[model samples]
Target: MSPRSGLQREVLSLYRRALRMVRTKPPSTRAKFLLFVRYSFHRNATTISPRQVSVIEHLMRQGRKQIEMYEDPSVKDCWVSKEMKEWNERT
Candidate 1:
């Protein structure tokens, strides 16, 4: 197989970081958190146009910020609940 592109590497790194952060969550909520992450990435999979480099970079930055925010212990307390709630509302 061929090597991954830079954008692909960045996307994978962000996904890995997000999953790593999920470990910090409570066990009871870990599965839900993982589902949320998977759903989020999958939802955007088709929305990222190959020609839009700027849009891809912007999404990467947003993903990084999301991971950072979730990593903060103070925010971690309500992160899953709030996110799941929002996800529920959206659906």
Candidate 2:
């Protein structure tokens, strides 16, 4: 594959940060956070075209804000829907 574009790299960096933050969550609730992260990333994976730089930029900004909110020590648990759980399990 070709080297990732600047926007792609930023998206990946944000995703890695999210996953790392997931590791810091409480063990009992860790799976929930993982599920939420995986589902969220995949849910949007195909929805946006690579040529949509403006849209991609908007989403990356939104993702960063979400990761910031969830990274807080006080945010112990993440809510995942049954559909999300099932989708994650299927893959």
Candidate 2 TM-score to native: 0.93
- Output the worst ten-in-a-row residue range by lDDT, candidate 2: 43-52
Could you give candidate 2's per-residue lDDT for residues 1-91 as a string of tens digits? 7988787888899999999999999999998998898888888887878888898888888988999999999998878888997898799
lDDT of 1: 0.78
- Clash pairs detected, candidate 1: none
Per-candidate count of clashing residue pairs (backbone under 3 Å): 0, 0
Best by TM-score: 2
Point to the candidate with the largest lDDT: 2
**CA displacement after TM-score superposition, residue 34 of candidate 2 (Å):** 0.7
Off by over 4 Å in 2: none
Clashes of 1: 0
